[model samples]
Target: MRHRRITAALGAAALALGMVGAALAPAQAGGGHDDGPATSYTNPVTADFADTYADPAIIRGKDGWWYLYATSDPLVEGGEFGLMHVARSRDMVDWEYRGTILDEGSAPSWATDTSFFWAPDIRYVDGQYVLYFTVTDTELNAGDDSAIGAATAPTPEGPWTPVAEPVVPPRPDGGGFFWTFDPSMLADDDGSRYLYYGSYYGGLWVTELDPSGLRAVGEATQVAINDKFEGAYVLKRDGYYYLMASSANCCAGPSTGYSVFAGRSESPRGPFVDHEGVSLLDTRPGGTQVLVQNGNRWIGAGHHTVVSDLSGQDWIYYHAIDREEPWLSEPGGINRRPTLLDRLDWVDGWPVTRAGAGPSEGSQTGPVAGSLLGLTVEDPAEGRALRGSYRPDVDEQSGDHALVRGRVWTDEAAPEEVHVELDLRTRRTEPFLVRVGRGSNRIEVEVNPGERELHVEYGHGRFQEETTVPIPEEYDLSVWTALQVHVVEGQVHARLSESRLGDVIAEVGLELRPGILRSAPVELRGTGAHVDNLSVNAAHEPVAEMVAEPVRGEVLVEESFDDAELDGWEWVREDPAARVEDGALVWPLTGADLVGAGGSGGLLLREAPAGDWMVETKLTLDLGDTEVRNYQQAGLIVHADDDTFLRLGHVAIWNTRQVEFGKEVNQDGFLSWGGHTSGPPADTTWLRIHHTTNDAGEHLYRSAFSTDGESWRWGATWTLPAGSDARVGLYTGGGAQPETEAVFDHVRFYDAG
Candidate 1:
């Protein structure tokens, strides 16, 4: 169900009075926006900016983008429940909604209609993204229907594939006293990962995972005990692992008593003790209180995660009820908790925040320092002034070059003529269009080197007049080119110049229509073109100028595996038979299979793909004289965590050689689905996997295979559950004979389309 506001519209007089009162109130200690004595910020960072977001789990992705994953709005009467929603940010302040991670129809069959997703925790590990989330069935009692599940994706934003079963399923048999929900993960320095979950009934529990982080390996240990506590998060600091959890009811809006408490232990799997030597296991005293409601207007601050800014300052992100807009707390209202952020300071051996004064309100300094404020434009000395919104893609090869990589439009009125220089690199043949106005009343100057022509046209609704000139043979299409367009009186002139030669390659003129208005904005549309310098001049006076600066923290990973060495990869199982030959990774028959006792073969990329990514590799499976077993597979695998993953394999199934797509969830047996079969033999198959999210935010995996590396045949498409951060690479196993060889001809990973 979508979140709905419940407040009644205030009268004009009442609204005016409320605004005047708010303006007259004294500023609190850290509530002023100015660089005053204290730094503070208002509550609900996304209040008026977006829909209500609660239970925020934020992470700085490997791609340098910040991601916020939260529980979707509950289903309304007769309405379908939405999937877990995700929002993205470049600087963590202004956010753009990326869509939900999963939708209704994407969940597994075991998850009944009564179940709803909640509180997701995401982590990037060993080149993959893993998500642990809570799910509860409304059909069962309060603490009886909650469970925890896991999912994986190749990138931070995913088409996540859920593990076939819940990581921690509900015990309908009443085997455990507490509900399994609100999951958080901790990765220790020694390559060990631990999951901390559970609610008030059985206290907060901790269990270790077997490297993959998909399956629990040992018995669960209770670390914190309290009548009203959940959302357990563990943070390791200064040789101590801190246990943080929310206490009291968290979803009751203004009347809620939710707060944050903390305990610490030397070990991640802890016997956590408070500052006063009080054990969290002792329900008689609970953990030490850290943050509580301090001021009016804001209440019930809880369910938090801590992150550090570029300046090395710790900030706690959480959600709280806003009293002024207590729409959710009104009579017969649903809980509406909006996200909030505040600084965390360390005091002695424990963590403290604003002297334990809960959440803050009003203006405050942000966690990060930089701002993306728009450029200031000055008026030109001509008819209608113009401004250019310069966007750049700075790389080592191009140094500092403005990118007209896609369509761009400006609000400034179109000028009669615009002058610009471009560094058109090779491998691109698309024409560049300098358009004025839009739709029917539009005119354009097109420079297409691929077609070797230059033209200028004026028209309405695709009806136009044009003058075209063929490009001179002396002009090199591989280098830079200078272009100009001028419209004066009732004529239009266009020109193009060769790189370094200054030779005019083409020139054209066209008759301009009468009553033409210079009112619409100017636009540039093209692909694979870079602008080194650009300027718009009006009446011979400069109106706009652009200079480029390098963009920071953009590239995550660019691997070719061309050196015939595993430079940025970790072998899941280092079989001595595997070697590099002719720039390809060759895994010889180790007599091992991918299932049962022989299911031990893997090689994972070391860095996780941040947002969306693709992995392509050419594989040749040599079965030798041994017959291909039912599952003798060799191809690519996309791992979410450790235990949950998807394999797009070239295998021998039922005496037929085919490309198969299978999934493994929580160590459950693989659910192999047949893909494109009856193609060419497996000796020279090019396998590729593309993982991305669609417009509706569903995680989609599109697998395809090629015979000659040029033409491809589409295989199967799989929809992942709500969460994903996946690792991708090549794998080979499950041969009937132990001695089978799988050869991979280079593995490539790139950002998805």
Candidate 2:
């Protein structure tokens, strides 16, 4: 005869790393555990490299040292100085950040002092290291002549000598070959060297270079061209040449669309094939493989150059938009893309990703549950019991007995009804009733009336239903939670227990409360009972708390190019649509531009933008639709203006498409930042903002999903950034919403904390 309890069930659901937990298996045969290299999620430097730098280049020199070169600052929007930087990694995981390898100070006379560096293709040719790169016009107004150039050095890092003039054809009249950039030099297995260049509408082209690796020997042939692409990196594996390039609009803070796409050709140059054999120049899929994403050790990783480690394993060197400095989606901010590196696991001749499949969950922050609640197993195979103190209501009208015990009933128990004999023998003269209740958050089930009969109640919120059970045989009450009770109010209140309402129904039982006649020995009993992971109703009521707002403040901005006065405030990069003069920031256009098929732009300012702050930025938007997808309005942000900041932008998604007809989207149109929650057509809108904190110590933030930015309603609220006192800044980006561009006029802040 097996005595079992009906209420010993545990909730089977557990969440791990934002994913659902799988069912557990009975003890496994432990012989196959690998004892080599103990590794866990805590292991640092496991998978840390990512993204491409502007115009990447690499070479394994004769001296057994591997050198990599990249063009500097293609992504920097208006910085004064620029130079070539280098990094070296022997194992590929540990890298030494070597400073600037080359600069305008070392540039040849043929190249202007203000020429910006593009891509640098380096190789060990003959007895010297030949470095080939492109130099662009400086004035932002000087169109193109920013063509490719070259230099030579005896070693990887050197006191170098510049080769005279541009190595490739000079920029043509109109847009000069879309500005020659992304140069790659490949030494074929057959002892021949070739240089690849040309981007934008000009496509991919390859020209033969002499063994010296400095000058082009023959005319360059058009290789491939289609989707205005750049950052071309060519590699030869298994007798096939693979051309990898960066595709799509790759800027803007939290809102960026950047990825690497590839095409393969049997020859060094020809019709390259994508997955569908569609000419890569015409129909390459919008980047099939994602090297990295947000919440990883690396983010905004693209524009890469792949190199071989000393062990022959391929390592990709690229730049990642540092989590500290996110890409601004809005206009009023600087455009900056940093360099980062990572290894690409290749199988079946294609690059593979261990991104989501790695041992530890990617770098996203989550709720903190310090330790496992002190839970114990009452029955090894089926039941687990959680122990805690329970205070109940008792009366003094009857004998010296006032207590109640709760128990659960579940399918895991062998008997139809669990035998619960309470330890009432300790007080033979005292009479008590036990009660039980069910449910997790709120208990609805309860039982009463000891040896004579038992009563059970089931209900929650407002609706409740109950039942009763009768007992005949008399056995000494065992000192256990399985069957215990105390008499208090004559009505007999049931002990509470709880279960998750979304799934199974949970049940509980408790003894009724009988009055106490006199003071007696107080010994707690019925403590080890198997109860479902349900909630137990309490005899006493609880108190609730109110919600509050987060605190905000001001400080100087870091990671910026500011060298002005420190008057307790910071100046932001100039907005492309505005002129900065006097003490005030002014804009030529009244509204932000909605970048359509081509794209849009804008910027935002930041005094000290991080930590948690309720930001209210005023934007003047024009309600018009862009003919492209995902394009919307200029956005506002808090947290440093880096790629990691949060965005508060608008949408013209609800705007009519007719507004973009007959003309291109490069004009001035004004649309107020109204609360428009719908898709597009976000014209004529007002703005409202809100941020708050909860009792759980978490910050909640949200915006108004309204038409008028003023008369706004609440939108979605998410957790705040995870760090100590950070900064805040403005943001603006291009999207596929309805508008071409959105503008910002003014912004204000408040201390919510």
Candidate 3:
């Protein structure tokens, strides 16, 4: 039995840092497993080097140090500022300032007296360092000019020389110039280069860059829409290219709602969409939120760069404003955006910061900060379980690697991250597999040469739909290929290389639920073809911790639904089908919603307790198992009006069932609505909305949800204008199928706990 990446019937699917810093691999990937060193780290990553460094870009220098660059800002309060800042670190935590890249003495000739540089993007191209940046205004043009410029450097800390002109000159838009900022460079598998740049005013775009990586060569294609996102960063993982951009107001003192979101496509030039398959260019744009404020002191977390530590773990470097000390000088002066770092985890094929914990406010385990793991097969091929007609070992060509004819499996361990690396003969029609679990719980990979694709399947006992990643055309399967698969806690990432130290030709990934691969075994299964150079390694399992939100204050106004008579509550639009029944409020779901187009759905509202108070609701609504239920929700809502309010509910959007805490406000001439999702739902979900006014008198609403009704996960915060009499109550709407209804047990208000 040639056990595939999974069972023959199904398929399955997948950190560290380095100290020579794995500069040998692409910036976003693992080099070879070269054990270097390990160290712990924490953030404000640049607190020791600078007071405010925003819109960061990072790269691993050839010298083995991780180099970081940031937007022009004062390094200290009321201190002299620089055009752009640079720093270097070995552990990715402790950093040393290497001084500014540009200043009065080193300013380019094309830069005007008032012009300045910002958002430095550093890349290693054609044996030298290439730097792309934003020029606020140039000597060649006037009237609101902002464009991207390029420079070349011999090293990370540079004596940089400017290119002839702006790589992407500012274009006129509505009497002014479109924002051409936040430059990021990419080199595709085909050897073509690209530059992504733009801002909230013009949208993010990707233009073909010349081989020099210093100039744009073709018309641009919009990847993200304007007025919603900016600060674009792109990453190629598995087989998809991800567009990660920041949304909301990036800077607004303590009120900043800035956050990060992501979309993905298979090509470098993308028709990208969020996790729900919603296009990024839609009027009601879709974005999978990746980073946000989790009720911590850190707010406005955005503009990030992604990197891998020596230990092969993925980490994101971003900037965040400390809510308590957001500004450096006067109130609402310059936002003190200290650099922060957090682990980036992939769940459901989408990226989320800190496994949905958001920004880190306390201490955290840092990167392994070390090289690529290498596995070797013994001459006698020891430990391999030979199944059926499989032979133990033989001299295939010059190496004495395992010659696989029938089937075999090897290497089992406890539930932890597992890394397997080996060389395989590719051209053969027979399939090869890398299994990371035993029994039913495991990830399986199938290398189908005929289809030129990798079929992946995963499960606890059963399995999921197979994900197919097409092989890159550049890959020549006739020769030996190095296959590296990393089975982390909840993700399976695999890449195929030309040789043991060759370029990665194709990559693919599959995300599984956590703990699926318990203390299991890593096995290699093959049919017909023989293999060699097999090695396996697993990390020491990590201890998991849970953070719970405390219940604020005593229960002030507890509304236990026990009778038909409801007191102190009024209906916005009465639904005849809804009534108090049994021991709960049994409200039949209505096929209606209250958003952009206005309200038709009924709402139950009650006067909110004065001062600061917390409101919570326990509800049960069967939206069925993961199915498309567009916005069908039932829970608590604090309504000021039909058009302006805040809602917390157990809602279904596409296949994802989550607790959505959303805010809708009538701004300008239309409605603006957005939300943040919290804890994964259960049969009985507990939703809470905390209310507190800031020093500016703005009413702040933060949400929390619990699956077990105890261990709560506090999520993002949304704000409302001060002095608004927002009533708090419950309702069920946005869906009107006869199959679903909400049973609300009670609505409780607590004073400050």
Candidate 4:
């Protein structure tokens, strides 16, 4: 259908069937320029520079800012992807990357250089900034047809213009055409508009538009069902009208479970249903979830876009996938898709996202949208920028401060892009600095909350350039957290939260060779801490400056069990109480679950050391929480027989607790299955896979994960069938109740160079 690209910063009196309409248009979203008071985020939400801000599409710019838009691929990683992305913010949680809206000398002179472009949507109607998108391929005829363009921008960071054709063309079919992919648009409070579009083979329609919303005037209709769904997104509320879309199989790495559902209908087009009434074109349809994947570290949470704020609430901004990194550099490539933001709520009338706990990972209460870009509230004891020991109070009545034995700079010498935010609490584990540029081209940063580390440095002292890292042991530091720091362009990222809305834990980056910094004196150093809100502004100019490389291979098979020897391994149902303590391998979980007829679970296979390899392990599995333990598993496999295989576990299913990554075949005769979802297992999770082959010969087996295996994240990719001899297993069992054990700790194996 519409694989998925997500984002949304909307509003404009939009509402439906239940009434409500017109009333948004006030949000500045981190685009209002963080003078901070509300806005406590968490969740990918474009983690400072697109790692993959897929199918998003925000829009909140009556000049206050917000604008987002994404889909063309890279803003990072090996680079070069397409020119469709755009970024801006002042509230959508502080973004800024902007470069891209059509290139190759401004594309769309009739599209068809293979035509690219994708998802998009944005809207602002009559006053300008329209957008819409999804061309895919065009040149008027031949195969890949796909259409629906349109553009026009006055500001949302666009030089835009587009629209000379395709407002919904190509329909064809058999000889190839159907996927006119995700578009969206809506409007109506009598002002009409409409648009929508299609996928999964000619399904989700809509039509109407015209008051210069760039064409598309007339019949169309349809609504949902063609092959389940595509990325639709409708909106309306109370009187109904909902719709939403996105279904399964989104870029399967680590077994993506692409979700989002919903149905409603008081009429934006026709009969939608769900909430039990079923029919989204029924065949087996039902819908009604509204962003899935709550097994944590986000999974393929569908393409979306909602927006409301200004105290009205709503929010949404979709695009997930980090079930262990999930793609962007080999392992079946390009899929990262960060950009997330939740809080949608609603309840009896539908709309869910956060209320149902779907994407959000921590730190909540945010989204007032925009209102603060005013600045200057200083106090630091009448500003001279403190120096050796410091003092000030505020915290509950204003900005805040308290450093104890050192620097605080920043009263005038700025520029280098800045964007700091310290909120402190620590008392002393030593290190503390923060400097940013100037003098000898700075970049310091000691930090050290009792060994959680973070020792940076950069061009001074003895020609510095240090490194370090770690910092996310739940970074306590006496409690009130929220670090942040973001020197743009030449890099120097930093994160570590707990309060600026919490749940970031750790983040780090560095760069700057000759690209050095220009305006320095931003300092902050400490020896006691408790600063609580030191802000430091001046940011918003990001066209590119991302990081994430991830390759690491080497070792070949380390094992590490410490005692009980199992030689080269080869069991299947062994379990004689399984032992080997000290270094791990415990094993217990048993309720025997091998899926279809091929049942019983114990496994342990071996023999598999060909080329491009990698294995990794570290299970744990306590499986207790909430209710029904219907699943209760363990992980790692890649066999070829037991009905063909591929596992990855950290299961529990019924009351949510995932890290799935399944794939059982045996198709023509029956078994076939599904799975995908990585990252977020913890209590000792750490899985890994990586076994390349590509170039079309297919072998591939990628999927990575970690909670503290020193920052990992990779995900997706799951092929096989290239000579197929596979082998490589490790198991435990589905649930049987109580006694759930499964320890493991190390199984290593690598050389995936």
Candidate 5:
């Protein structure tokens, strides 16, 4: 997500070279299957390319290479280094990381070196590649200071030349309500061009562009409106114009409420309506929810672009935050936003994804046109499964004898053990065996016929162990060599022999654990691998028991803060200023800001549960002799996204301390309901927030406060738009006084049902 950071001191040239070297590092061996050429693909088409790339725009150049551009970083609080970054791919599946295309030194003279370059849309116009991008001031705040600019290059990869001036300059103070950013160009069939830009501040606006696409010509027109909208992309299909835009905050770590919504209009610029006939201008409910965050592994899936593959299948490209590997920054932490790809399907008259689901996780089929070999399997229990994108190839002679080449992804948490039995024959020495997992946490068994050796390697993270033994001469490599493998509880046991269920030539055991391995796919790799009957057995089990149960008329959590450990609560960001001390959750003020829109510095604790719930905590603000600032707050919060939340806290209004309640709906910015008392009962107060389903079936959040832990006075109630699950927690930050401290004596959660 978008979080401020301290810029790195590396020069542009040095940074470019380092990125090149990291991308060119040799890939791991025997990743999954080894077939002829790969034909299938999966998400993260570019694995481990880079950590932080967002607003992906990809295009196939005339040079037969695919080029991808995105918002690059030094992502400093007040420094902009590399603007637009580029990566190229020959097969569109494996991308080569090229460095930044535009740096601070090469940017337009009018643009400050600290301006944030975001969301560039490129298209070939009039035989030249035209690039339109958004630029914001050093703070990267969306306001009148944001502008849209253009550049041109003869080739997709180029030393681009920026236009003498910005194509769409920043508006004068209070000139317009909308923020002029996230520019997208559409080339109409009637020989007209248009540029679409805007954010939730005003609405989506479109204006006619000159044929060169270098400047705007006609008057701007409003086509769509939504208080939670950004990232406008248009696609013309049949006789309708599809306007796809992202709603809510796209970069709030795991708490992000980002999703792609769609509306259609007959004209390129006209009134747009969702499938439910709801106008885009309606604020009560948003546009049709097309794609949302699915699965716990990947969250915040939005800011997307749709493209057609060589085989005519539509694929959606976007960025998602990996929950396990969040990006840390100076002020806050951003969930690792990596580029991901998924097939887009057209069902009825609307766009649909796989199984009508959202972002994909684990293993999936690759694109249709790649050279990678694909394997498909069907079982009475597992149904139909297809795996693609195997990098190696088996010998031609081995392919003739090969009966089954299986590639399967295994969930480490499964209760049942996995067993595989196959056969291998070789005319020459080669590494042939089965592989489980990837990277540092991997397990493999290799049998080299020519070397007459058998080896087993297994590891967790960087620590690993390998055991090898000379192969018995009785094991014939010219004929079928039976192999059987059993994996359970992070351990693998393998036995190899000349015949099925015959005398074993070698037996090896390797220790591995599922916790370290995560969810890793298994691959049978090597040449001369011949097997008639390949058996894979894994008994099915229900997943509900493995996950936290939903809150249903039961006490979900109750922490007294007496124990110095945060067992059930997780920190949203790892800040040194926050800790458990003296039987309370103590968050000391660091003079950091985490109060305004998209602010940071607060210490937050999150717990995920479904259904109606209430979270209450006892907050005590201790500033000693120092005073609190207007933005400083300590309270209980029901945070849905950066802009959608309900906070009931002890806040300072114009330096006057008060117990205030506020709500930010649909990312339109925060609004206080003005139900504050003179102060927070001298320092200690009970803060309570409730999230429940109203009679109208809409999700509503309510806050209440009390001087003591018993009696309460209800504050304000706000309705939530339709979206994913939210997190409830206690927060303290944004205080002007660096010595201030907000202590939570106890926190409790109860099912409101």
Candidate 6:
């Protein structure tokens, strides 16, 4: 059920022989160090459907529920089967894996013969629910034309019944074989239904569906035929029809690769060309826009589906090999492709990944499992006396070890470096190093200590053992560090952090095993180091904290905000023009408080908050010009602790005709209050905000605006670090049409969420 792997710090101790040979090696054998803790999408809001989903398709039903369908292992099986799984969610983030919804084994006679059922798309047509999918021949890779079938049900998850025979038949072209597969359907304004289907082979082809919404109306027309295409999607945007498809090889795990391509045409059928003027049918690399690439942590990314949100934002979902997992044994090893999903932003009508920006820090923010991979600890646990063993005869409970103050230890030298080679199944992000003690001194493998200070070390090892190489002390890391191990010459390294430096750790005279000694033996001495917030690289951005206190170590705030003493901080008016009473900053809006004709004003200070901190403020606004000043705002200044900070508060004015209901305010000048609004504001509103760093290099500035101060909602999330010297202050400046003052109250800052 829950598959896991151990940290791969020493496994690379073995050569890249076949999987079996590496598996049998002793002491850091089997390229074991090459496997590191697996990092998935970490943002809870964006990570959904955390399962081995393939050929993913999502459709929103009229009932407001979004249904997700995937073509393989819907019920969590180890082997491949022609079964489609189902999942549902109201918000795209939290998906409830609903097991199997459709299976081919129980299919109608016409479909039972097919084994490979793939790319299922659901649509609602004429008060009826339609499911379109492709079923391949039992030969699998024989590449013969497959049949497109139709099924219908009232609900999204269906005990579906077949509507009829193949909706689209095999190709009539004379290319030896017409492989029909991966079908998607879209309805046009004139009541015409179109189906787009194709494989990674020939190209994407389109056909008209009969009014009954089953079978082809006539001969299928070749629409877009790019050789690098597969998993095609058709949707209409701004009156123009678009076909989105993935190009290149896919389903190959870490090596699996492809790029999303797009083509536009007036009609859903006929000659479709990419933006580069290349024919859709031609297999070319440069013909399509590269939406994603492989490098650093992400080796392969492609095979995607795009979905639009309530705000018109489109999201892209695809599968990629979790590079942290090594290549599977031969054919099956490279086939475990993990699904990856990210939000897509449209720049000039062209889709691009908002999170994927090459292999750089702050390029992506993914989700993680709700719980750790069976490992338990606090936010900042240390690694001391932590020993792991891979003994063939040891049991799980027996070999398990605990990290103390961040170190592991052993009385005598073990045959291997700690127990790194024992349990290769557990994956951990906690930094661990082999440490062995030798009387007066100890040795270490320079594992990341999670601090910015220089860590002492010796030697780095590649999987190849031709020669044991040494590394200079001064190891630094962030989110981009790859798994690495250090080897000592001569004596087999013992202890979790102990290593025989041949001439360094006592003249290479120690026996490799425990309870044994050699006059000139080498010993692996030193314990593993485990620290909190240890990223792969050393340059990742920090997490957002309501307040930052370098004096209290790193801002490791994972919960609420409270401080015994508000030390090293000052309470200055967020709005300079506003008055301060009872030691609380307040803004009182008046005619003079309003910016003059075409002018602007609010408040500012000279200095700002340093490190990772967040600020929030409450405000009220009453204004005129209900039409022109609707989105007015008042809020806090982030990045800046003082005058020269970035402010996202309201812009509405004061004293204008208005309407009121409950907490809703309708007026002109100095209207609505709170953060991140552009036009005007409502009357008497309170805006509170939070701005801070994202420790995992999630560079984006995270801020939430709230109406009731206690209940916050996400407003705008962006990346404008502004280099750290930024301060916080209030500012209300907009609309030269007329001016009104906005009021402010209740401002505060804290260390974390």
lDDT of 3 by residue, 308-350 (tens): 5543456788998876676677222567888999877665566
**Top model by TM-score, which number?**
3
Sorted by TM-score, highest first, which candidate order results?
Answer: 3, 5, 1, 2, 6, 4
What's the TM-score of each model vs. the native?
Answer: 0.44, 0.42, 0.59, 0.32, 0.48, 0.41
TM-score of 1: 0.44
lDDT per residue for candidate 5 within 499-527, as digits (tens), equals 22112355555555556543355566655
When 1 and 3 are scored with TM-score, the better candidate is 3
lDDT of each residue in 1-753, candidate 1, tens digit only: 223211111122112211110010111223222221123346667664444567788775533456877775532222234677777775556667787787665665456575778888887544457788887653334443677788887666787888777677665536633468789887653446688898755568888876667888778787876343588878654346788887655653333446677888878877888765656665223355556554345666778876643222456778776644433322224456777877655544455455344476666565532211111111111122223433555533224555566775554554443222233433477887877655676668888878877767788555677767776544555554545454433545454542111113454555566645355565777676655323332211111111121112333455545665677787777777778877677786554655423356655556557656667788888543224364577888876654456677777643335455554443112322212221233467887776667555656565666667765544334444556666677777774464667888777666664
Show where candidate 2 strays beyond 4 Å. Answer: 1-58, 68-70, 73-80, 103-105, 138-142, 173-177, 283-287, 290-297, 327-336, 355-753
Ranking by lDDT: 3, 4, 5, 1, 6, 2
Assess candidate 4 and give its TM-score to the true structure.
0.32
List model 6 lDDT by residue over 124-145, tens digit each: 5544467787766523234455
In angstroms, the error of model 6 at 603 is 65
Model 3 reaches what TM-score against the true structure? 0.59
* Global lDDT scores for all candidate models: 0.56, 0.39, 0.68, 0.64, 0.57, 0.41
For candidate 4, lDDT tens digit of each residue in 1-753? 222322110111112111112111112222232233457777776787877878787865543356788877766776777668888876778788878888876667778885678888877554456687888888888777878887786666677888888888888876777888888876543445677878556668888877666888788888766654688878654345677787656665444667777787778887888676666765434566666664456667888877654333456787877755676763235677778887665545566665455676777656654322222223344355445567765443223456456766665665565556554567678777778787677887667887877666578434666666676442355645545555555556555443121123444455656567777656777776756435455543211211232376778768888857767888877877778899888888768877666677778878778878889888877776546586788888988777667888777655446576776665323454556544346657788887877655667676677757876655555676668887886887776687778888788888877
| Number of clashing pairs per prediction, in order | 19, 154, 44, 40, 12, 119
lDDT of model 4, residue 136: 81
For model 3, what is the error of residue 601's alpha carbon versus the real structure, in angstroms, after optimal superposition?
Answer: 22
On lDDT, the candidate that comes out on top is: 3
